[model samples]
Target: EKAEALGVPAGPERSRLVRGESVTLADGRIVHPDDVLGEPVPGAKLVYVGDASRVDDLVEEARGADVLVVEATYLEAEADLARKYGHLTAAQAATLAREAQVRQLYLTHISRRYSEREVLAEAEPIFPHTVVAKDFDRVRVVKQQ
Candidate 1:
């Protein structure tokens, strides 16, 4: 806007152009000129959450993530135990992924008391993209239009 303020105006004069000092995102996030842009083409975004019970800002933090790796330590039926242990239920993790709009949801840090099939069954109805993490399993996240 400096050009407009100073009446530098626009035309064939390349030098008259003024590059804004900052770029503003729709969410009101500001990007400085010196900021480092992450990822390359198709820009993948991954959010990793450990054994958290309830993270207040998790939804905002994981918004638009291509992949969200979070803990699902128990089934919804054992929500009380999950809360007692500061862990999340399978359904809770799925809800978080859905709210965050992540493309893929990987459930991890499961408790020994529960089976992977049970956890998967609890989450799949809420978020169809949910995956019950297996040891040494690998997944590639790619941005989609």
Candidate 2:
């Protein structure tokens, strides 16, 4: 249903992209954690970037995102703990957003350890437009004037 709205082609090929192996997917392939895929929108495309092991790929995939939905589950104060958990601290995520030149960022998958206020306080400094996502909340991405 969502794909139809997005005009993404339906098929197994659109399910996931095979990493490490180069793929020649048509426009609209939706890339999964392991597979690459995209939805259709004329010349628009979606690329998949994997984990820290594939950090370069992640950066490339975020090249021109209007909004980047990123996870900043830890604080810089706990950098060691964050690395152990395979998560990024607020500073790291913000850096990525800035590097990618993303228009806006939405932070999610937050750790339950910090209160909402703490999360916002930690992230806001690193990324000026950052917001801590809450359950069942909706926010439209708006351009800054």
- The best candidate in terms of lDDT: 1
Model 1 accuracy (lDDT, Cα): 0.78
lDDT of every model, 2 decimals: 0.78, 0.60
Clashing pairs in 1: none
| lDDT by residue for model 1 (50-109), tens | 989885669999999999999988888888988899999889899999998889999999
- Number of the top-ranking candidate, with TM-score as the measure: 1
Worst 10-residue lDDT window for candidate 1 reads: 11-20
C-alpha RMSD by candidate, in order: 9.9, 11.2
lDDT of 1 at 5: 36
Off by over 4 Å in 2: 1-57, 141-145
* Residue 85 of model 2, lDDT score: 72
After the best TM-score superposition of candidate 1, give how far the Cα of residue 1 lies from its true spot, in angstroms: 26
